[model samples]
Target chain A: MSQVLTIDGKDLAFDSGDTLFDVAQAQGIYIPHLCHHPDYPPQGNCKLCTVDVDGQSKCACTTQAETGMSVQTDSTTLTEYRRALTELLFSEGNHHCPGCERSGNCQLQATAYAQGMTYSSFKLLNPQRQIDASHPSVLLDRDRCILCGLCVRASAQEGKHIFTIAGRGSDSTLAVNSDSGLLADTNLSAEDRATQVCPVGALMVKQQGFRIPIGQRIYDQGTIDDLGNRRPQYHSPKSKTARIAGDSDD
Target chain B: MTESTTDSRSLTRVAIDPLTRVEGHGKVTLLLDENQVVQQARLHIVEFRGFERFIQGRPYWELPMVVQRLCGICPVSHHLAAGKAIDMLVGAEQLPPTAEKTRRLLHFAQVLQSHALHFFHLSSPDLLFGFSSKASERNIVGLLEKHPETALKGVKLRKFGQQLIETITGKRVHGSLVVPGGINKALKPAEINVYAKQMDEIIQWSTEALELAQGLYQADRKHADFGAIGSPTLSLCGNNGNFELYHGDLRVKDIDGTILLDHISNRDYLAHIEEEVKSWSYMKFPFLKRLGKDRGWYRVGPLARVLNCQQMDTPLAERARLELVNQCYPDQHQSVLLYHWARMIELLHCAESIQQVLKDSELTGGELVAPHGDRNPECYGIIEAPRGTLIHHYKVNDQDLVEEANLIVSTTSNNQAMNEAIRSVCRQYIDGHGVSEGLLNHIEVAVRAFDPCLSCATHALGKMPLSVEILSVAGHETQVLERTSQGEIQQRFYPC
Candidate 1:
């Protein structure tokens, strides 16, 4: 029997083992997530998709939908929490939006805009990060990374196992699995799912930046609420089989 | 601080800090003796932003977009200049015809809008209402209240230019259009058509604005002598020695219209140009290396371009240029006020050029980027920004990150000339008078004629204020007068 749950006062039906996020997404309700991609196993690292389930705040991406469960996807308290989480993400890294190639198309930037986050109130860490551009077709700028692990999962799913998260807590960073710690030594190609799954400018294809123009960019057309996880795909010569994240079935 | 000029009389220092109606923060100081005779005058730029150092260790391709942060008023100029430099870095000696034309179009729009803004909004009040008019009456708001039609036309003209930039570059300010070897996108015919339909109105408005500036200059005899100083002028000229805003060799002309240097290439700029660091100001003084610092100081911008170039390429601007030349009998063009007239003529030229470029079929369809050439370590991008000549020089290491960067912005190039202009104004108007509103306005008017961008010159960022401090003969603070960034004036006196 199909399980029914109440989300934001709407009764939604879901199958067994389906997460609250997946059920809401299937019913055309966007939970405003960054690290949670539909194609990959929900990591629930970014708690932006926090919802009040039965008077308890929980990560919608990890919480399984149950029969007769009440879930509030959005509220004043949840918005404040989401905004604080977004601000913390910004303050934890050096995110210079103007200089970033993914400025208008970045999901992090779009999500921040949707949450009405104009500036970060927390003290910025300004952590120094590394840039790995050894790969001819792709560049890895750790400064823009949010530790989404989408790339780590995507690379593992592709059987390349090129990316892995290293360190812990505030020191955690997206690291390459190659022995030399360089992207050139990895088996990842520009067409690899790992290269295509980056939600930010962390893993960008070389020579394809600022091509879509400003107003025509993914987020520029509409807010993240209106266009959830839709990115303008730039097809490189070697990117014939590359797919945009959340667009194709796993 | 005050200095004793003679046994009986001592020099009192008067400073106008944070000069108003300009892009950045700067000040002017004059020393007066007991007789109220002007002893010395200097323009001080107060902040420094080391942009060249900031770009170090970054990839070379990012220079075009990265350098736009230098100035909000003229980011397009920086973008294009850096693009030209990056083109050389990637070994693109020649851009595709379409790429070249598109860049030119963007530059013309930039110049058009910048000139309109300076004239209609920044300096028009002084010209229309008189430089010595009531402080409250000499502003954009005042202009709008009295002359709404003219103010509206100025706004629309500036809007047209900005919209044109947005259409081409995507965003109005700090937008990305130029890439390494060429532009990122082509100008579609529909986009061209949108601007093409507005060309007639744009040209008409520009022509009317030019007439207003000319009429104002002719009507006021005082303008002829206001801040007049003799100096050598510099700008870029076409291969044939015609007025060229984009892609040209350097040309320098003396006060007598003698060519000091001509056809100097961008790569050889180091050999011809050099910057001198001064103890007082963050801005550097750039002059012709051949002439040395004492004599090499030259003027730049619309006045310099008009004086240095032989003729304008477009017919309308050429006619206006000739009229200006005829009005300035021999040495009359040396008047600082002529910058407004020359700037309006260039505005007309840009308007005509924009219309001409839109008709070009190459913009609709052609090769976007040029084929790569042998990569080089060092390259220079030089272009005539709205204010004056802008130079961007960069050297990249083997890893493609920028190893070094040196920029000589337009305002920095005119630093020495601005000081000279202020000195001339002090000697002419403030020689025997106390610090009055009219006298202070005269000083500001002199500096405004140059259309200086202190922010771009210092590579700094912040709002600017105007303050006047009177120092006693003993070097003790006697009185202070300040004009805040919000245009509020506060005066304080200290008992000796």
Candidate 2:
């Protein structure tokens, strides 16, 4: 049934084509989601981009635009759901932001940082994901992938058709799918436009690596603040210990 | 790259590919006659993209990311401009004192790095190799052979600046760190002492560099005559008449040395400044409509900054300022070679200023941001780009995302002026019946003198080159236009 949703006391009408996340952003409410870039197709893989739709939960990225549907994108209840989701994503993935090349600009690191999720309370488990360092301009570390599907969509849709998903479900691994299993073996150039579109440090820019120092970036605090006090806010119940321990908190 | 000269000349019809003298991107052409006079000249800055236009619908918080893409070398310029613009958009200028100092120090670091790149990599070849040397080794490699110690100092100095940025931001290159409300990270005093020590060595290098740069013009006649005496152009910056780097009121002057707009808010930059697209290239020409076409040959950069400022601040710069003015015009030095010398003077000031700021105990973490909460007024941030005055203007909707964006980069301001510069250089060197590769290479290098990064200067994005042919009152002229590999073509034309 179609319904006008009142979220944080604002009237919002959900139509057939509206994503709850989209509606929330339009209403001046920010929802923290790393896997669901506004520009990329929603994976609902991280499940952090979840929102309450009508009386249930929905992954805002994959959820279809609907008509007259009431939606709640932010609240204490939803925040907890998001915290749990981001926490899991962090714990399941291997994210050593300080050591990662994409620490400052990595969406995963930024999300974890923004959500205050540092070290996982869950045992490291740190299952291994294959790391392919052969590609000159980009690398693939399966463990850090988050399986967000941003690289896949960007390469396939935005970049004419260089990348594809060969396997389905949990067996999924992003493959070059170009007759060869290697990235450097493909027709990709170092200046490949799609490769630069990655949200996390997963697809690292090869030539630009290790060029600048730690303290003097062009934008400073992960592109959110200069070198001063307006520090970025990261909160994740998963890494609650780190926040209190100065690793996650500003 | 070919240009045709005829009864009517258009700067758009010529192509000077692989512009020799600039830092990031270059190549321009001037169509002229047998009389050695230019009929038309097209400043074919073949790297252009619509970055401002691209960021139109992005969330305001995403501005730092978008604007930082302006220049790979000068990203700090864009970051600060965009951050200040957001400050205006959300009315959050009340950020605590710590935040302001953080930005100021970061900005200082960038200026240091950018100037080092310009002086050591872009222009040092000329300074070290004798401006008129016919040697093929006209680059950093050449400078290394002659002055290895100086070359090493240059690398370390630029590195120090980038190091400072990385330590605070977490990454050196593309950082999503700083924003409108406040700084995301703060510096520690203990670590800063390490930075200060390195800065001391850089200061020594800069002091020596100043002497070397001044000595070149004084002793070398061919270098002096070739580097000096160009048509003058004003570089506008903040500060009504005060000399400052990062922020202040703005003042515009003509190449003839007349002040136009003084103390104007960056919000009104476009209202006063008009950007014209030339058919020859992707780079746009920004002209003062009030001054009209040929007269709007205003430029921004070290030369322009020193000229526009009425008084000086800081002692080191003041002494160098006195020495630099002696090489000014009426002395007939059209070399445009003054960029290296001027940059060194600025570097001296930046280092000393860094010392002063480092001494501040208030630079520690606390009260950095004031939160985003307010109206959607058109916000504009106009600050001094290492190349010149840079402006970032944005109009946001109620949701605090960008409704529109317009950037007036330092390079854009000098587009018309650069066109003139190429024409003058071509007349001086390339206008004969035949042009050789080495000489032609030098002609392009002359344009490089300004370190013209059309990708940066144009407030645009990306580097794409397209060769086009245009037929007009003159004849068939080949021009290279700036286009993206994405198939986006940006062609512009300059008027006489």
Candidate 3:
């Protein structure tokens, strides 16, 4: 009924269909991740969740759990590689934590904190990007986007189909699937799952900024390791009907 | 000091642009005549943030959060005002009793914190230390160094208010607690008990603070008249003619204490009041309709509120107000410096109200939020912010997306009054030969008396720091006074 896998020298059991990420999360083992929500299908776009399995580097989110597999999660090599990936993600966007409203709540920022990234090693790519406030309720800050496509995937899952990637590689950008290319034209409400799925501050709900006082945000309450339960409820299927704790204030 | 040469070229101008020790950015410009007489003075709001234009196309429900970004210092005022507006848009005028009580408590906390900040952090430095003390010494640091115990009490008092905000709204700067029809979360018994305990200390500290402020005021009666000027007053009062901050009808009164306009609905503010936009400043000057622009310019904030209201609801504040009016001043205290006394009185009222609200068990009721109802096309929300009356108007489409938005913030209402006060102070103190730091401080005292929020008035984009300059003629720069990052005033004489 269940299979065993040795992760970081600890034996853990998994079901036949469970991905390596599911097994680690179920076993209370944290493999730093971004672009990998439990409710959504596994996507390996972000290579930050990579782990050494049987002497081969595999993405924990997309890779299926196998029997008797020796996985090295927190090894020095893996830690260094994950740090570089997080650093690369940081460099690719303007991730100014102090200025960003989503600093404490952001999964990317939380993952970077978990990876012990005190500082970014890569050169800063301070790309000049447009902040689209045309939508009224939501602000589309392209500068904060890391191209994870979480909003796109979440919207498609909800049958909204309002978000999509429009280009290839570095040129690829998140585009609203509307003729006007603005959120106002779409039927996106403030309570949409797509609005909650942003790993960064890219798709922010306006006026909700700076509401959560500093020194008492998600990270301030507990480390990411202990704050897994407090993540944005985009992963919950009933999120549409479920009243978000802070959503009502806006 | 030697008399300056009487020539247009020799005349000097003093500018305190990006005024320090207050929220947001504003500047005071004084022009001296050829005879060394002060000709004119103006307070210019230099920043403009077009939030009304940019908020179009947003869902009406998001307005509370969207508008609160206008000023960091008074986000709660905007947040609650926007929340009230959205409540009207959603057709929920009579909110649940529990929700009403909760919002009332939140409003009290906001007033307490804002007043604490204004009195302790911003104004107390000038009051505690002599106004003409060293630029570096007449600040919070100086207060901390000289009066550490008093400074600590102020800090703790401000913290208590912020802590109350955090307890209710979940954060202080821009708490996302209040919604369209009601608040997001219900108060827990544990949270209520904690605040109830803390209120005792807060009340005690506030009482002592009132006593201290009165003593300070009495110490320098002459200096208190630095910015005193005669102006008509406009404020909001409760339905029963009682002092009100959260909800009220707009009322206007003349300089001689005669009621000009009475019991006007806030929704019809545009019909009763008009804004005159001047080319020299970004802030629009608001004046009453019947009196017209020339005589209609009126003062707001504590001075106006105290003068217009018949009674205060709280006992401690009522006694304080009676004592203040009967002994220290007349029925309508026109002196700008009395604002400090009125502010302290209101602070005491807020503290007592906090206690009164916390004791009520209805605050912990189960109904935390109201169900969404049919939407309206347009609505207006008005509330008395800490500085003065604030108004937010929004028009929405059938889909509930914001089509147009307009805001007449607290500081904007006092723009003409502030300019008039500055003109009066300049004429009284400045006698050419440029201006001394002491006189400039006196000029700043006039503007500070209103406790203006230039950021909310101008709604400017990005951060603005304070700086002052003195110019001769049109093109020639003479002197500059800039606020360093440490908030100390730095003097620089520019080569002509």
Candidate 4:
């Protein structure tokens, strides 16, 4: 029999190198996440998918699944932590849902709704952010960026290394790799996989906004929990499997 | 307590703060002597919102979706105006035929719904019941209780308009449909058929509403003189001098029905109109440049449009327009109360127009965007909103961000007209009478006739409470009465 672990009191078989999040996802279980993408190496920075492993808390995306291990994905403490993390993400960014083109289809908005977050409890920063619209077809509005680094990883995977996170802590920002520090000067194209992975409205394909009317967009058709992080209509040819399986790269 | 003191020469200032049954916060102050003879009357706009300043540095294409936050009642007007401005900015001088028709459908829906809301829900209580009726019983709720069928019709009519908007744009309010050059989506045949089925019922209801408004105006001869003022009127008329709401040349007609100005392009508005700033009010007074400040002030909205336009395009509304012109022939109709009648006529026109546009096959499929031409740095977009002409001017930088924005909303155009109405009402109803609920409502009724959206004019935000105060000329409070936001009345008295 394959080595087994217990997640939320249910038995799950996992390969030796499979992470807890990977094993759970293989079993059709969802742990809320923002910084995790199946094609990229796991980054536990968001801490939204934190789960109870035995008696200690750990990020399911980064934690290795061990035989006979007991894991809990849902608990009062986990819910509070997840909700607070989502609220903090909202407070940090200028995520105006109604005005955003990604409004109904946005992952952050859908995740917030899943957490029942009507309003942010934390003080809003309303941080002034830069916009990079110099590109012919792509726009990088830092105001809506959550600094999840998915774009950074996807760009690196494509060998373009067009995006990166610069600075640290509250001063950290989504920086484009270009001599002029503008998206236009970068080699990034609208067809780049990195441009399609933005969970918010930050990295948008110019002139293609609101093309899919609201109430017909990705998240509008179903909740984030039900639809997962897949954007069916915007999937790249290389990521067809990932779109179908929600998170699996296979 | 003594008659000598009661008849003292010191003027008493009566103030109605936070006037109700209107869209935004406004106050009316009238100065009267002991005999209650009116001396001075003023309408004050108390709040200020700087939307233009904040819109700077934003991408030009975002204007249509962004500027719509100006008002909940008329977001579509702002959306269409900004879309038209952005169309010029992007150098799409003319839209695709399908795009133009789609926008026209959206605009007519907005006008139909907004007019239905104002006439049936907001002002019907005053018309159906007497204007002097008790405040508690003079509201939409009271109207519903007394006439459920009429109330239901109003609600349904508004719903149909909102539903049509949703069908076209997606959401009922603040939906994103317009893009820089044209609309984002075209209506499927099924969607157009949804509204097409309801056209006859909507047309019938609009005709009935028109009849009701006409009946009310004819029944009351006093309406002819109520808040009546003679001022020049302005609107947009097509190249053929036909009544136009979406796009046309600016036309100004004198009080005596003579064409004072015609065929003025919207792009040259600054050369013709100037806005004056006053110390007491946050709202600006826009006047015609040629006429000067004192004589330049003019009226807008349904009365102005009906008086200025040569003819209505639709057959039914054309007949209604002829009847109105015949009634007020030889002299322009200046009665503020007639605005209700004119608005109903437009509402009927919108209903008929909606049906006409839906039958066009171009709405189902065709080119949706025009090829952009040479981009312009600055441009103006002007449209006749339900209330009146709304102008949106913008200057964009090299980076395609808005460098400057100037908006003259419908209410701002009517700011001077509203103040004049307040003065007229004070002179007629409160000149020699003590402050009473009935008399105060007459002042509100006069303002309501203009349907001023103070929120849009001042670019402000917030709700209003009703408060009345009596003060001596020395600025000492003599009596104070307040109606809280929760609709509770509280009174306090002070000896002068």
Candidate 5:
């Protein structure tokens, strides 16, 4: 039941119900992604992972892998598109990479580096953003948020429903689920998946800033191309049956 | 905390503004009588970071990380001190044994690297070359050019310490590993084994450094009398009266080596010490409550810690201390210049302590953190940072949002004493005539002995202008020299 597809003129095989992102990841090909964690349901909000499939532009995260479907991941047009997307993200927020604690490890920053983006192409829109520090174990700096909705999806999957997206277009913003609109008012702990899911510096675990020194962070060692093949260390909990099966072997 | 006395009708002011060779922005203003005798000397902090005001809305857990941004040199000090304070808020009476040992090891590494930086990089340039050495030949570059091997050794030693910090906490400058209750990760067996293997090398380098410092001092007797002045010493020591750099109870010793106050809890620092604000400086002067302002002012740092401690924790440092106190300088090692010697002794202690902590088998213990309950409203965290005692106090609400904060850093603790030391040096050197470059350098050397970190002390952030002014007898400026750009220092000569 295996089928082959061509990606960037290279033949790759995948089973049924496989998305382009899943196939690419399995083939050790990095398509520069955020808002599409392997463990969480795909949101396809960020267009950084868009690929040209059969002469049509489509988000690889939302597209299904088809037999003999030709896909282009790297090209002059695609490179410019991803580069522009990275620039837009940088310009929309106050992303002072030098001052940010997550500068070295941030997915947006790493993706930009992977695309050879030396500087932003668009004018920086340094909007005044509110920093929500009402939580005991987390700090929410909206200024650095790219509004990918990973936290919103990750927390919802954990049944906490701690985050949501409000408004539309340029006015859209991240919203808290609790009545008090503070993390301390909820049962959120430092170990929550939501706290660990933010790919940016927007949602940071307090007291852990700069714990890892510069030039030694995960992304600092190598490009995402090298690290993209490895499976994520953290993932969603196993099902009840899977857990029982795993325990029997132990 | 002396006034500038600009209003004085008949006083000549010699202003060594934009003092060089220290951490951050500062100026020394000396008021002179008609005979040019020093009337008063004041050290002014020109910048303020306002960290306390901005941290208000930040969560209590973020305090440890946010406070560290206050200083790049001693970020680990603020990091650990804030962690301890937040630990109180989290209701952890004591951290897990493994967590405590890991923190101790991290702190020792920090101390080792910081002391190495202050000695080999900051102060040793003046000591190895001369206080009056040409400005062109009085920097790290000059040290590299003159004594390449020694400078390399210092760099290697600092790298060893910094690597340990990165290995344990995962970052060199501001790593976010220590949580309120405990450290996020335990020291791996492999990490400990590696550090344990390097212990002998660290010890040897530190021993050689101590010898070099002693040699430098003996070669130049003039340095001893350069900025020599005695004042009350203040520090925090363990219950056993041993030298403590990480955590301890506040202790004050008179200049004559008598314990004036002991065993005062850190929670009551505000009750025992009060800050006096001057109009000319953003920095505050901290004085003991038992004595009035003039008598209560005390000096803190390696000099105070060396003279006040009953004994060092490690055997090598203790032996070094005995030699310095009894064999080298019998008069209790009071000279400001001798602070370099005290710093070297501490460096040895840190190296030895690192070995001891790493050798402990409990370092690889499985328990990394303790259980912390609901948050409290307020708490205080205090520790002996590389500079001296640092205190972080915060008030928070039920949601863990900070409402108010107060920080008392080490350099601020020595503000009054620094001014007095500058006055003493000026009295010994400067006259009615304008200061020569050498005279200005001597004053800087006196300040450098304390290894003052004014950036953290003032908590001021943003662009700061540097200026030096010469005032006439009527307080009118005769000449004003301001640094036009940051890079201007490289082109400008220190000695004119």
Candidate 6:
């Protein structure tokens, strides 16, 4: 038997082995975060997940739950820090969310809203990205990439190395094997890139244009957020990662 | 103990994660002795494409569009294969007369592009340069740097094919217009003339390309030994017994050089052929297993086509093919190594096929798709896409909803044999003492010998990983979904 914990003076109950974030979720409370998909590997690198625990700011994903523990999800201090973190990530890459295709569905946009971020203080990194129209199935717009390395990881771990990161940290980007330096020359296949995985418009369907009517678009009937980022909530069954992860959930 | 000696249990297994520089991700493992004699070879065809069975509930017209998703590199193949099968299922004469001509043109266009891709992209590396180039320069770029004129010719030829595909199907890659029972559009005479011009240029260039291949063959003899799957190669060139690329009578030859099958109607394939399931791979091997042999590995596609046909239509390709056969000494090498040379020869033939089809009487002006009063309850289709022979069979019920489907793609035709070819290369080339990227790549590329649309052969990409929960279908009145990726379930409200 595990004792219940209180967060922000409210009683929250969870299983003994649940992570802090998992416990927070069971209470119907949320903490602003990105790079923390339940199905994907959690790195807690977003830094926006900082929460107040014993007067210390810590990531909720990696930290374990404790009995009689008191915590706050959105304190004044934590909110300010999270907003700052969002602003910096925005400035680090050329994530012009408004014009981006991934604008509505992107995690970066969702995190910014959650933290109540208004604007950025730092200038944009303004990295140049090549749009490959070679492979007929999908397109890869590099400028929108936040370097979350989700695609890189997906291609390597799940995709089993059909794609790879060719360079070093800041200098690195996902590169295909074709000499054309574009997807057209590489061996990138349709199944390699599913339509719904990308949060932003960075990866768009190339071959089938406007076949998905605006009324029936993925974002049309329900905002995944309003629906919840859980199965039948945040995840689309067509996503390769979501589908692969679905087995473990069962 | 048979030939090569030493530790028997320690077989060298090479895991080419995503096996690069080839179509689809799959791996090959080889068992051998210290003496280097090969034992068992297994090809793990990992991507599950179940295209054959997925179309049971879909519209007959959507089959071509859906089937096109099977291969990213050769969408036109499935589109044409499905179209041909649907046309036959409705009875060829029942189809709108113009539909047949348009389908043929589309088929030729696909052959042109696919054959060109094989020569330029898949097989050229081995022929244009040493098969193992450490320079890491492997692509059209590499081809251009070494031989600019040849690369340009290939680009032009392939582009011409794409133009024709786009013109007829309305899109370049995943074309959706080719309908069952008939086509969706017709090739205009003006468009036909342009295609003819492009075909003329392609014919000249591909002929020269074949000549260059002949010149290169004297220097490259090893390629002649690739994919020599036991005995006679399974082939589907043209039923006319000509080395044509469009319609064909399916044929299989035994190792004794006897024709086991001279004609195979699409409806009879199931009774004559059967697919064997293997736990080691996702690909199901189709064999004349009904013949009661040890599940004989049957092959169909380029190598099979070259072995099956004795004559080609294009004068230039016919001459080159004759020369290619004469040069092989014992003549059996025609199926073994000629797949590479045959692609170039087909490029020459496709160039001619494209030119002739464009001149057909119906393409100048005629109706495209035929009238569909209702869905046919059952139909079967078989046509030659660039990859090889393709088959689609469907069964529909009273309301015209689909009931059952079975597909046999060109890739399935070679599944078991591909495993055999990989082992042969492993024993001959790979060094277990160390990992040789070069040796590993050549063997992997050998699977490309069939140019399989791993996904296309499986079916298409519209597949969803749906998790169906069968909660005792509520009552005995619940309908049985005879076919579903989700297994069968009975109706009952038996709760936990």
Candidate closer to the true structure by lDDT (higher is better), 5 or 6: 5
CAPRI level of candidate 3: incorrect
CAPRI verdict (incorrect, acceptable, medium, high) for model 5 = incorrect
What TM-score goes with each of the models?
Answer: 0.93, 0.63, 0.80, 0.93, 0.82, 0.58
Q: Candidate 5 on B214-261: residue-level lDDT in tens?
A: 789878767667667667788889899999987788888887778888
Local lDDT at B69 for model 5: 80
Error of 6 at B356 (Å): 1.7
Q: Give per-residue lDDT, candidate 3, residue A165.
A: 82
- In model 3, the runs with Cα more than 4 Å from the true position are A1-27, A37-41, A52-58, A63-72, A75-165, A170-223, A227-250, B1-11, B20-24, B198-201, B325-333, B452-469, B478-496
Tens digits of lDDT, candidate 4, B162-280 = 99988888889999878767887788999899899999999999999999888999898888888877788999999989999999999998878889999999888888899999888
TM-score of chain A of 4: 0.92
Worst 10 residues of 5 chain B by lDDT: B455-464
lDDT for each candidate structure? 0.82, 0.62, 0.74, 0.82, 0.75, 0.59
Clashing pairs in 1: none
Question: Every model's DockQ, to 2 decimals?
Answer: 0.40, 0.07, 0.15, 0.33, 0.21, 0.01
lDDT of 2 at A138: 52
Candidate with the greatest DockQ versus the true structure: 1
| DockQ: the better of candidates 5 and 6 | 5
Instruction: State iRMS for model 5.
Output: 6.0
Residue A161 lDDT (model 6): 52
Query: Of the candidates numbered 1 and 5, which has the greater DockQ value?
Result: 1
State the TM-score for model 6.
0.58
Compared with the real two-chain complex, what DockQ does model 3 have?
Answer: 0.15
Query: What would the per-residue lDDT of candidate 6 be over residues B7-30, giving only the tens digit for each residue?
Result: 534543323333321245565555
Tens digits of per-residue lDDT for model 1, A39-157: 88988999999999999999999998899999999899999999999999999987888877788888889989999999999999987788887887778889789999999999999
Provide i-RMS per model in Å: 2.9, 12.4, 6.4, 4.1, 6.0, 14.9
TM-score-best of 2 and 3: 3
> Residue B243 deviation, candidate 3, in Å?
0.9
